[model samples]
Target: MTVETPPERPPLTSVDQVNLSDWDFWARPMADRERAFALLRERETPVFFAEPVVTYATPGEGYHAIVRHADVLAISRRPDVFSSGQGGATNIPDMPPEFTEYFGSMINMDDPRHARLRRIVSRAFTPKMIQKFEDDVRVAAAKIVDDLLETGPGCDFVTEVAARLPLKIICDMMGIPERDYRFVFDRSNIILGASDTEYVPADSVDGIVGALLTAGMELQQLVQDLAAHREANPTGDLISSLVNANIDGERLTMQELGSFFILLVVAGNETTRNAISHGLHLLTREPEQKARWLADVDGLAPTAVEEIVRLASPVNYMRRKVTQDIELNGTRYRAGEKAVMFYWSANRDRAVFADPDRFDITRHPNPHVGFGGPGPHFCLGAHLARREITVMFRELLTRVPRIEAGRPERLFSNFINGIKHLPCDF
Candidate 1:
């Protein structure tokens, strides 16, 4: 297929144009390293690969990295040129076959197909639906804060509170059994583990991938059963809604249903979990900012959301392949080459964000790419994710007056940046 081509980007310095090989494409480390590198890239070159030898392929080959704020915003707006269909699944590939196949199911699809699937469930995630979640979010936040107080100070908040609340809510929304909450959480780690190292234990690389496959397989069976259940016993939950949801005069097929179910579970669970963890980390790190936010709960909630999303960027960078030979930023065009957009870099562009490295909670008129770019491929669940974090912070500040990060742990995957152990003393 001849791919739509983006106009040639402006020329870059020799240092900025160094080729990045496959193995060198994504160098996963701690959260701090990513922050530093992102700042550096924005300073030197707005768009460049993570390593030399830009043309190499363990999967997709030869791709450019878009880190500048303007470029990301521009590309995100024009879905036709920077379309996410086909390989637009996410930058990091090589997870489970089921997940890969499921990516092709809908969300990553471009144009008519994406619009078709999205419109089907768009009602379920509409403004009203998002607003209605406040009650659930409040209850969940209260439960977590209460649980933390009952346990007292010195706890890994990410495990005890941050990740679980959203995971639980998302599972509840998807009609997943409570017993399987941890299973869904575990699988989500592997699926989005593209950028962190926590997913890969020492000498246990395959473990992550295995968990992903197993989870995807189990989710498939569970969804199959749920669809059957919905058929017999309809309810008002998302699963039931999806069961009856139709697009283009046709209901979703078995696989499409399964993919939607799994994506909702993974997307909602993982992204919100990171936002909560990162938000707490940011607040605890900056007591003054946290206090200000606490004082102005109603006003600071949105800013807090943007700060955390921009700071965390939980999903990390997604990869895209060039369908045909094309030149980009003075580079020669070559067919079947691979390139990617490193969102980690885009959110920190110096030109867009003042003092890009500093975590500012009250950043005015923030235009961060925490929710991806504009147009058709923008994140649908951003509303829910932001709401969950805001509620958690509002409740958390009420319960815990002072907080500090005790000990922190990050994920092993290079794509989904997250914290495995965020010990916080409150």
Candidate 2:
């Protein structure tokens, strides 16, 4: 896909120019987005904006744009007052009943239900299992690099390099067959890229919602079939373990399994994919940093991976419903209201990170909320994502030490800071 030139936006001279609800706001240049959020972060109280209208769901009361690092951390810690389940954490607008069946999972839930699901899933991510995944990540990264070398450069880095490792790792963990990899990849792109015209026509709300639901249903059906088979004849894969294991007399229902799988694949795939893509671009732009990392690839891998995620902030914002009237960080929020935590902005908060815009791999004490804030909703796959990034970059820098990224074709959506395509050369 071609990278569409972003329409010229007037300089963000005033906070009034910043509207988090505007679709056009998201499509603006990256520099403009940074300026817009910086303006929002300067305000004493969070700015409230009317919810974006959609045909599938009614627009509720406007949501506060939580841009500061401290506020994001505070609201995350107080899950009792700010709930993820009243409507959903994934979207600003209330998730309609129909959307919940496939989209709803532990991420959009509160305690008891969230705890139960988390507990069940956590059992599968045991130390031994994680070690196994790490081993697989190394092998997968190497294979991906091997293919990239054979194909040579001038390829879309997002697809050729960044998207491959996470997609393969997630699919393998779920016991998805090799033949079905493309099927899963396409569906996930639709689910997350529905707002982008390349994936779904932006003709109407009906078209967007239809594409999303169809992708979700197709994914759920695929998992259900695999889960049914796993139930009868278990294997060493995660699907088999989830299907047969009993955790404190609790088991994930087929619907829960399907939704969780959808969450795992999409969340796991997209976040790491975007991070890797952004990492390449960051390294390319800051060649000195790349040289610094290349001097000691193994030593700097951990810090480099983190710095990339902090800057990438792939899954941009998560919405929460105010459960009670409360005062947090000198701002009062009424009960039955909504607050959207912009992780991307929080990561760039000046109060937290010194020289936040600079790509410093050795950025110590990096308290970035790229993986969500400190709460129960913190990303379950964060460890895996870090591992995937570290391994992928290690392989890339070691093999093709001079690789550089070209202009990126970014996704046109507010939800995810994604690069649909990025050219590369070595």
Candidate 3:
């Protein structure tokens, strides 16, 4: 998979490189990410300076940049030394100690506990289960597209279609009621928007935090209610499966259920939303590549989705705390320090890619870190995410002619990367 980053504009200066605001986590625009990574890659070392305490793993006391593609693989694979527990899970400014207590959550846990929780959740998100949801995703995507078509051609696609579609689909899979969609959406915005000033915004910070706390409690309560319901009135939705599921012959605790729900909501909605919005924006920006797919009109949209994920790299990076003193990417760090794997940078490493900036949908040997990481923490929702994007492109590229980018609004956060407004005047 020899891909190349096609050269473009110069990297942003350090002043422009600093991330600020509440929405920086999941809503950072694709263009800004390219600028930031381009600057981060300019230094001699593949890795460089990222103020750890300020950017990622904020509560803890260390920061590192394993910017190269190879280094990301090495650190991710060796979870023993680079434990995911503690401040690595999120870049939250002042991480509440309460959140870390339930540190056994799959994303933060290492070895036995991580393994155990992953196993429990893995059963529900299998290929077979996703296959069952294919029609549901298509139906939902079609409805979203049709709604856009109904309102005429020119529309802000990201806000209307991209953000809402997957939110519904994931909620459906999780067995959350439709009445709760607004609530779920609110909390997702808050938790993911915690970093950048753009997404959650200064005015909404208090509301966002308060909403997130309430949302977590609601999820905990819902899981218990659904668990009791499933025990008596067993239906086969994800919630039911979780309630009835047995790990080591025991059901998960309320805290475990909350974390699992958080995982699905945070993981499922934000990434897919970014991929959809960013993909549309890319097609508009790169006419030649967009034209190539529009001409094909068959399964080519799926290929475009892959390119979007590869190039957009919606997940900025997943942080890990080093358990013991270790050396990686020619840099050394002590125990309890944080190593943030900058996926956005690694995906564009010059050494691993040839002319790495070019977007080639038909790039045959695409070994992108967009989905697969080197080891166990690979995204469980990869299949489902792919389904949502594929269905969307199939509906969108065919329905909307000349879907050009019209000034994408950026999210201020550094964690969850995405576009807020992709106004397309089709």
Q: Best candidate, TM-score-wise?
A: 2
Angstrom error of the Cα, residue 119, model 3: value is 0.7
2 or 3: which has the higher TM-score? Answer: 2
Q: Mind giving the per-residue lDDT tens digits that candidate 2 earns over 265-314?
A: 89999878999999999999999999999999999998888999999999
Model 3 has an lDDT value of: 0.71
Best by lDDT: 2
User: lDDT tens digits, residues 329-351, model 1?
Assistant: 44443444444666777777777
Candidate 3 structure quality by residue, lDDT tens digits, 1-426: 011233454544673454422233223345655666666666655442445343222444436766678888888788888877655355523356655432236787676877878888898788998999988998999898888888866778777888888899988887788998877776776666654455444465454445456656665666567667776787868877877788779676667877778777877898899898888877887889888988886757666777789888888777777788987666787886767787877888877777788887776566678874778788899988988888888888888866677877755556656676787777
What value of lDDT does candidate 1 attain over all alpha carbons?
A: 0.68
Query: Once model 2 is optimally superposed onto the true structure by TM-score, how far is the C-alpha of residue 257 displaced, in angstroms?
Result: 0.3
Error of 2 at 175 (Å): 0.5
Winner by TM-score between candidate 2 and candidate 1:
2
Weakest 10 consecutive residues of candidate 3 by summed lDDT = 20-29
Question: Which regions of candidate 3 fall more than 4 Å away from where they truly are?
Answer: 1-36, 42-59, 92-94, 101-104, 196-211
Candidate 3 has a TM-score of: 0.87
- Alpha-carbon lDDT, every model: 0.68, 0.91, 0.71
